[model samples]
Target: MKYSKATDYALHTMLFLVAATPNKPIGVQQLADRQNVSPTYLSKILTKLVKAGMVESASGANGGYRLKRNWENISFLDIIHAVEGTASLFDCSFDHGSECPIQQVVLSAEAKMEEHLRNQTMFDLAKKNKNKIVW
Candidate 1:
């Protein structure tokens, strides 16, 4: 149910990239400033995104981060997994193996949530909030 702050930053950073300028690279400082977070910390998150092929980093004065060519097809679940990993949210403490009823329920819920997230992309979100958000 609960996710990391890194995931939160990553999601917002991705949204900003998609909404503000998908092709244009934005510096880590600017991205951090928007969320009031540390540029160094945000950089670490960006690194993960880069490794995941969700975004790419450029060098030099106008260098920064920008979405990849397939960013429009990137689902929320993709971003979430990129930062959070593909580990299950809940793991039953008891040694009930794969037959654990409690684990089954939780896993089912997680699957549904992931399915919903998989249906929602940053491009869709940006388009929906285009008028509402400044970017």
Candidate 2:
């Protein structure tokens, strides 16, 4: 299943922030530039994360975005749900409330995916990718 571009940006933003110095906020422009995304678009994504309680923002000269929780506590699933909601690959609902035959199968797959994502966290990923990625 494919997620929206917003979701991709949100994940990237989270990963970037996970690497930042604690209590030190990163400016939107700086983050946008580093991520190679539009500042306006990134700001909207950051707002969504902030509202989801995954990230926090500050105001004034030192104003910027930071994670609300530690990277170890922030699961990849959390970021996905924060940006995309609990959207399934296939909609199980039908008109008149009719039960779809494939609903169970789809739901099972979704559950598996959720379980896998929930088991993984930003800190875990950072450790795994530390040597491979630049940051």
Candidate 3:
């Protein structure tokens, strides 16, 4: 499955926050500038993270955002679920209303793939140690 720019930015922004001090809130503008993303777009992503309780926001000069959980605790799947939603790859897994058996098999396999990604945390994706992202 391909990740949208929103997901990519979310990951980059989250990692930036993760590397920051617990008490320090990095400004949205700063994040955007550093990641070369639009601040407006980044704000939308930040809103999702805030709503998901992945990050906390405050207003003013010292206001920005801080991770609600440690880097290790926050997973890539969590970010995707927070923004895109917890949409399973399979349209219907538990309940099969279609009459086609082939559809059922496809759905089962799709479900398994989704489950695999869900189980693989963000920590797994960000396995490299302080290396320049070659993307």
Candidate 4:
């Protein structure tokens, strides 16, 4: 399933935060500039993350945002859930309240997707990317 732009930004924001010094808050403007994203849009995404308890925010000149949990403790699914509700591949709606014949197959795929997401974490992503890129 395709995620909204907000979810996309939130994922990047999380990755960027994890790459920074742990427990150190990074300003929105600084982060936006580094990621080449609009500070205003990034701020909205950060607010949602803070609300999800995935991020913490501080106000003032030296204030900014930081990850509330370690990268290893945070998963890609967590970021998606924080921004978008569920990561279901597809939502099947049947006519007249009748269940679809292939409901079980759809549900199975959704479960597998969730399991995959749960198995991966931000730290895993960072390490995997740092390893190499094969053409």
Candidates by TM-score, descending order: 1, 2, 4, 3
RMSD of each: 1.0, 2.0, 3.5, 3.2
Better of 1 and 4 by TM-score: 1
Q: Each candidate: what lDDT?
A: 0.93, 0.82, 0.76, 0.78
Candidate 2, overall lDDT?
A: 0.82
| Deviation from native of the Cα of residue 96 in model 3, angstroms | 6.0
Candidate 4 deviates by what RMSD?
3.2
Q: Tell me how candidate 3 scores on lDDT.
A: 0.76
Lowest-lDDT window of 10 residues in candidate 3? 126-135
TM per candidate: 0.96, 0.88, 0.75, 0.84
| TM value for model 1 | 0.96
Which pairs clash in the backbone of model 2?
A: none
The 10 consecutive residues of candidate 2 with the worst lDDT sum are: 92-101
List the candidates ranked by lDDT, beginning with the highest: 1, 2, 4, 3
lDDT of 1 at 102: 95
Q: Which regions in candidate 2 have their CA more than 4 angstroms from the true location?
A: 93-99
Residue 28 in candidate 1, Cα distance off native in Å: 0.7
